[model samples]
Target chain A: MDKVILAKDVSLSYDSNQTIIKQATFSIESGSFVFVTGASGSGKSTLLKSLYGAIKPKQGSLIVGGVELNNVSKSKLNFLRRHLGIVFQDYKLIKEWTIEKNITMPLLINGYEKEVTLNQAESLLKHVRLKHQAGKYPMELSGGEQQRVAMARALSHNPILILADEPTGNLDEYSSQLIWNLLEGANTQLKTTVIVVTHHIPSTLNVDYKHYHIEYGEISEIN
Target chain B: MKSIKNHLSLIVALISILFSIQVFIVVERSIDAYKENLAKNYSVVVVSEKRIANSEFLSIDGLINRVEELSPDNIINRLNTGMDQKNINLLKLTLPKFYKLYLTKFPTPKEITTLRKNLFSNPSISKIEDFSNNHDITYKLLVLFKGVILVFAIVVSIVTMLLILKELRIWQFKHSERMSIMGLFGAPTWLRSAVLFRLSIVDAIISSILIYLIFMYISTNRFVLQQFDNINIKVVIFDTLNDFFLLLGVSLVLSILLATMIVLGHKEEV
Candidate 1:
């Protein structure tokens, strides 16, 4: 019904050296599963960072769920992050804490009490098929298993939008298909807007998703 | 907020150390003071080469007349014949020597040891005049302890900060990502600081409990406080508490400063 994420004339650069995506613009609608594909260093991760307010755009504006990203207040940024589910390229789960604890992190940050968070985490662990590894740390789990935990952690707070840097970059075919199924489940069950960034486009991703490509500092939606 | 639960272990650790150290210093000082008082009183009756026995061999009228005629500040305590004064030659003790007397409700082993040292090789003094109206060994102990506690607090504070700082040094480079997650977790600045403050308070409580138990145990023993009556025990216990608070207060303050510095400094990137 409304734009879940939007960027107008957005540009990002480091040290005034070079601008990667100049005058780039796009809007992601709610309840959409979008795949972002690009060659190496096409600013896909940078775009996601901008959406989560981790990086301030050098020019123009980026809005997530109607809140401005450029020079936004920290309180508002925190509130924005509360509703956002971001997965890093390396599946940034804390190594010391267990899988369940990692999954409950966002909710814990959002100030949900222990019992509520625990119940939700338990359910999410079951949903992700990591129920047996609830108490296992991230390092103990395989790459695919860790990715699943990351995805579950991203989805734990019931966030409106999930931005995954690379959902299945290093996973096996079985794990990749499992990740896709989990993504599809969230999209259908919770109507969550999901944006997945990847350099690979396996032939198996057929969930009625929109496709976008990043090339030569520009973005375009594929027909 | 999540870090609070995480840091509870550290808090408990800090509290335990502080509690033990506090109790140790208190008991140590108490023992030293008790011995000192005993030694002071022993210095009077024990025949020693270091001190001259000021026995009043003259008649009562003469002794009284001479003592009264002397300086008004001089105080004389009359010795009864029933005391264990037999075979104790007061005249052989070193004469014309000043003795620091601590009149306590109980005998102190430290005072005894020290007075024994001073009077060990010399004759014992019999008749005595108390020139200084200084308080008992317990009071002197409390006063001296006020400084010792301050120093101990400073040492403990420095040690705790250095330990935390050292751990943080490793965490900064190796576990910075973890720190960022904690910062991003919506835990308040004060709450983060409370991690360290909680440790200090924990330390204080543990130290207080330990010191109190130790005092109750050691002071209750008739052997430990052989010189003091029950009333004196109560007074010493009451006064030791005063000493404990003074130390605890300093330790809390030091911990607060260190915890704030470390938490704030570590919150940001390197």
Candidate 2:
């Protein structure tokens, strides 16, 4: 299978004095479900950030979807991000916009026709079981519902890859299970490559997923 | 309520700036019109040793628009106390030639001096009376009034613009979170800040309309017309088509340019 992300000896740091990820090398294959687990300060989020072109790799080449991310131009990075879906822990939805509009954001950015974008957003809202709350703003929804809306948004564009950062960290058990099921469905049904950065992997997840643990600023695969 | 306050701040600033600009234009036009009226009524009386043609006065100074000989018949008739016609004719022949020189514009003190010197350069011109003292006071007052209005307009515009910028920056901060969220989703800069641009543009249009209405009322008001009439001067305070379009264009350009500045500055900080 072709590799969707290839990082060769990548290092990350916020400043020159301290390095977060030290010369880590990894490659994620297409259509593979992967989990990255680490301690609280083990730079798991930092690694994920490099994948999405949020932060540049300090040492080596970090390639995502066949584009080199190290020193990537802003326009080029934005173009790459348009093809990828990203989920944050806080569920960064524009509170002023309706949930339906939030879901349609990615499609609109990709320059989809208005009618097509609205129809797809409606379909995704139904898929997330939030069809009743389509017109409601993000502030009006519960935390779990907001995350679910975020998940729906991630899947709205049918992205080739989804990078989720602690998607269900603050959710209830029921919401957590629902999120896990959605991730599994996207992985198995849609055949999208999924890389999630979390502290713990849920034991009830049934899908076969590769796991990578970060320790001491180094990433190593676990059998 | 908050949105209204924001819009209000921008609209008020735009109105003040546009009002200052309009006042400056009106003051400038009024001064020009007043100067033209003064030029029409004022003239220099020149006494020449010889009979100088009107063409000679034109060659003396570019300021001389027209020249007319002052007919001596009136003075001759007034002095005649049953005098003979032969003596009256001799008196007319010996009397110096008097001509009135009309200027193209109301002359400043410096211009009057230059014209005086130029007229005296011709040996035939014996005496020239420019009435500089009265002209000097009127010209000085007009200059002072124009200068004061110009400075006031400039100061008001600058201060109002700074306030507008501050308000716009606050607006940028308020929308930064939403903008950053859209930015993460790969939306372009223009798309992300579309709300800011829209608000500013709407305020610009609103301000333009308000100024147009205000000026239209002032231009047609009986009191304003009475004041201009009392001064015996005609000034075009507002031109319905030209001034309206000019203010609208200025407001739109200013708002857009300021909003772009805030957007670019926010981007750099991020």
RMSD of each: 10.3, 2.5
User: What is the C-alpha DockQ of each candidate?
Assistant: 0.19, 0.53
Check candidate 2 and list the clashing pairs. none
Q: Model 1: per-residue lDDT, tens digit, A49-162?
A: 777776788999888888998888867877787788877778878776788988998887788999999999999899778899898888989999999888888888888999
If scored against the real structure, what TM-score would every candidate get? Answer: 0.66, 0.91
TM-score of candidate 1 to 2 decimals: 0.66
Residue A18 lDDT, candidate 2, scale 0-100 = 92
DockQ of 1: 0.19
lDDT per residue (tens digit) for residues B33-111 in model 2 = 8899999999999999889988988999999999989999999999999999899999999988999999999998989
Residue A23 deviation, candidate 2, in Å?
A: 2.0
Off-target runs (Cα >4 Å) in candidate 1 are B1-160, B170-176, B182-259, B266-270
- Stretches off by above 4 angstroms in model 2 are B1-8, B193-203, B268-270
